[model samples]
Structures are given as structure tokens and as C-alpha cells.
Target: MIALPFAKSGSQSFLRGDRVHLRAPVGGDYKAWAALRAESRAFLTPWEPLWNEDDLERGAFRLRIRRYQEEAQSGTGYPFFVFRNSDSRLLGGITLGNIRRGVAQCGQIGYWCGVPFAGQGYMTEAIGLVIPFAFEQLRLHRLEAACIPHNKRSTRLLEKAGFQREGLLRSYLKINGLWQDHLLYSLIENDRRSTTNNKGAR
Candidate 1:
């Protein structure tokens, strides 16, 4: 996993991993981000919220960066873009958002990988990078994620990453313009330690 420290000031973080690195979104990334999202629209539309007509426009991208910064400053969210380490190509995006502190100490995680990079384990490693950030730097106690029931790939990914299925949420999220049933999953700070301990005992 990447070892770079997260600067609370929202400065650029170089979270490097084996094949991918994660960093905060920047205005300069507009072109590559847009092209990848545009080309992967068909591949991604099924799982994501409906995109606005101007979602990929430069102006919209600018506002997105602003919102991300605002959330960062407020200590409620963090958004990162995944890039290939070899050439620094944009591969995907991930966000640990809606953080709740003051006892809850929890957050939600979401991500997407462009079609060209899908199934290549980039998002998986990207997820690994964020888990530590959420649990250690942010000191979050729990992390939650949900996806449509039919998205078997996501289910497998979450499970492989040690997230346990919590339950089903009927009409949980609007995806591709329709309400869909989503299966919720969660991981807590102790789960990692328990797994490691079990491995040692074995």
C-alpha cells in the first residue's frame, strides 16, 4: 500500500502503491479525467448516480474541486484520483465521504475505475491505500460501502478486501436514473487486527 502521509491542509499527497497511486483531484487533471470518464460512460453508468449533462464540463469540474476542498477543510470528506504509477495515467477515482465523528467515527467509501483499467486490480489496490488513510489518519472507526445486488464484481471485491455483508437496502440509491436495491458492507478498525492475529495463530 502507499505510504505517503495525508496533509490535513489539502495539499497534494503522493500515496504510492505497487501499480497505482492516489492523490487529491486537481484542476489540471481536467482533460484526462474527462476523456476517461467520457469513454467509460457506458461501462460506468450502470453503477453510478445519473450524471448531469455538464458533469464533465470544465466549469463543472472546477466546482467539483472546490467542493472537494471544502469537504476536506470541514473534515467530512476526502476525494482522490487513482493514477498509474508507471506513466501517471489517470485510472479511476475514489472518495471517503460523509464522515461522522464524535462517537460514530465512520465514513462512506465509493470508487470507479475506467473500462480500460477495470478488472486489473487497480481499484483494489487503490482501496487498500485508502483503508489506512481512513482508519489511521482520519482515525475513523468504521467504513461503509454499498452497491447494487447484481454487481457481483463489486461484491467480490469488497469481500476480498475483508468487508462483511451487513444487509440489503431496498431502493437505497438512485443508479442510472432508477432506484436500486443495494447490499451494504462494512469494515471496522478491529477487523484488520483480528485477521492478522488469526493468521498468526494458524
Candidate 2:
């Protein structure tokens, strides 16, 4: 596994973009994260796994943070909270998970935006920031994403980010309590054009 560098403060360095920054979620973020998820429940439920009744509770958020940290330390995943650079408000989250190294240097990318922030280009910019971090920082060769076939917004976002439609996975995941098919998409390191011209964060 590759080691990720961290700042002296023990916080992971930020990945900035034109208007957003992606960073690991801290303890203080629980409130905002919970509020946003609560507010966007309906908007996000369709694309996410079935939520438990206490999914957004503080205890659950703490558990999530602990798991995120463990995954980061184990070099198996990197989770980030997207924030507006201007006001530092949480906008959404993007994660690079299931990292595979050696013969297959790749990972899976997944993301979601606050309902109010959806379609405003936040996730696009966030994805742009994460691509380089995955390729250059994490030394991964490819990133893959999957979404329901009817999720035009997600499919378009993947395409805009330079991911090619690879194939379909029948009943790939149980989303919102039922099996759902998904369209697979991928981006390789050689395909720099997709993210390079997107004005990555400094």
C-alpha cells in the first residue's frame, strides 16, 4: 500500500479546485453533515443504499468518521467532504474507495451532492480535484464509477470527467432496499485531457 502524506496538524492536506476544496471530515463536521443529509434525504435516497432509521444520528456519524479514518490509514480508501472555498460551507462528499494496488492500481469513485447544491457544478469540480489526487498522489492507474442507467445527471458527470462507459452490471448493488443495475464507467491515467483542462484546484 502507498503511504499518504499528511500535514503537521494531523489533518490531511486539502485538494482545492476553482471553487471548492475536498478534505477529510473532522469531528466538528457532524452537525453540518447530518443537517445536509437530513435535508437532502429524499434527493439522495434514490441513488444511495438503504438508510437505517438512525443513519444521520450523531453516534452514526462518529462511527462513520472512525471508519473513514481507518480506511485512510489502511490505504484502502480516501473520503472527502466538499466545501465551498469562499464561505467554507459543506456542499457534498466524494470518495475514492476499494483501492487496489500492484497488478491493478485502481479505485472506485463515488459521490453525492446536497440537494440544493446539485446541478450547480460543485460535484464536477470536486471530481476534477480528486482525479489528480488519485492518479498523482495515490499513484493509482484508473478510477471507476457506476450509476443507475436512468441517472442521466451522474452519467453525464462521469462523461464530462472523461470516464468512458465500459458496460453494465445487472443487479450490481442494493440501492434503497432493492437490487439495481448500473452503468460502469472508467478513466485511466493516460486520459489526462478530461481533468487537466477542467481548471484543477491549486
Candidate 3:
């Protein structure tokens, strides 16, 4: 098992990396969360599903928190909000969703970084933190991620985090306002172990 060196909580599962920490979203985060999303609207909207009219409102955030809590309580998914460690500023969010257990033992990884935080490696560190959480804490066999084929930044971040490109998913998800193709990538437990071993051997 991989040892998580930084920090982790018992139930809340707050993850801490060298530069960032992730905790489940709560009602109190509404203001800062809304502000970041509003500022990064143009950078994020194109890659995300169409947002509701009141998506940034407090009521909507509360509803979203409820949904996330339900998903976690049901053991179907886990969501975390990424924050900068230095000043505790909100940077973005990441989630391990659509979890499948039994024979599959897999889950999908999804995330978004605010425009100002993009290209600064915060998302990469966030994903690095989640990998162990998925493979060790959750005991998931595989983790999958998908991004639009032309999204170079997303592709780079995934590759940097050790995800291997699998295939193109034709019209796999509805992004913004239209269905679009996506590139699928995955990192399995054995693969992660092998990578770790190789790095250690070198």
C-alpha cells in the first residue's frame, strides 16, 4: 500500500499535497467557489456541461453539496474542492465519480482548475493526491479520465500524472451545448505500482 505522507482525515478524507489540500465542499464555500467559477467562466464553460441559470447562487450550491453528500454516503462517488495550501485560497475542484464496484472496481476522474490557477501545476498536484486516495483508500482497481481530444492542456496534465491514452470516444459526452468526442485514458492499480517501482529502481 502507498503511504500518504502529508495528511488525511478519517471520514472527511481531506487530502493534502505539498502545495494544495482538498476537502469535500460545504455550504460555507459558496461565496469563494462562486467567485472563482465566475472569474473562470470562459475558461471552464467550454469543457463542461451547460450550467443552470442559478448555478452560482447559494441555494444551488447547497443543493450541489447535498447531491455530493448523497453520492459519498451511498459509496458511489467522492468529491473534493482544491485549495492552495499557502493561503488557503480556492483553486478548483476534482471528483472521482461514476464508481463501479464488484467485478469492475473502477471510477471516473474529473476536475477543473480556475483560469488564474491554470498552467501553474495546481491541478496536477491535486490529481497526484487523488490517485493514492482512489487506489489505496478506495481500493479501486482502475481509474479512468476523459477529455476533449483537442484539449491540449487537459491531455498534458493527464499524461503528466501517468494516465495512458486508450481510445477516442465518439460523442461520448455533452460539453457546453453539443455532444463531442473525447479521448479516454486510464491508470490501473498494477500500472501505478509498476511506475512507482520503476522510479524507485532508477
Measured by TM-score, how close is model 2 to the native structure? 0.91
Please give, for residues 90-171, the per-residue lDDT of candidate 2 as tens digits. 9999999999888999999999999989999999999999998998888888899999999999999999988999999999
Query: Which consecutive 10 residues in model 3 have the weakest lDDT in total?
Result: 1-10
The candidate that wins on TM-score is 3
Best of the candidates, lDDT: 3
Compose the digit string of candidate 3's lDDT tens values, residues 1-202.
2222222333343888999989888777889999999999999999999999999989999899888888887778888889998988999999999999889999999999999999999999999999998998989999999999989999999999999999999999999999999999999999999999999999
- Per-prediction TM-score to the true structure, in the order listed: 0.92, 0.91, 0.94
Q: How accurate is candidate 2 locally (lDDT)?
A: 0.89
> Compared with the true structure, what per-residue lDDT tens digits does model 1 show for residues 1-202?
2133344434645577999989988888899999999999999999999999999999999999888888887888888999898988999999999989888999999999999999999999999999988998888899999989999989998998889999999999889999999999999999977987999999
Q: Worst lDDT window (10 residues) for model 1? A: 1-10
Cα RMSD (Å) per model?
3.4, 3.5, 3.7
Overall lDDT per candidate, in order of appearance: 0.89, 0.89, 0.90
| Collision count for each candidate, in order | 0, 2, 0
TM-score of 3: 0.94
Candidate 2 pairs with clashing backbones: 16-201, 17-201
TM-score of candidate 1 on Cα atoms, chains taken together: 0.92
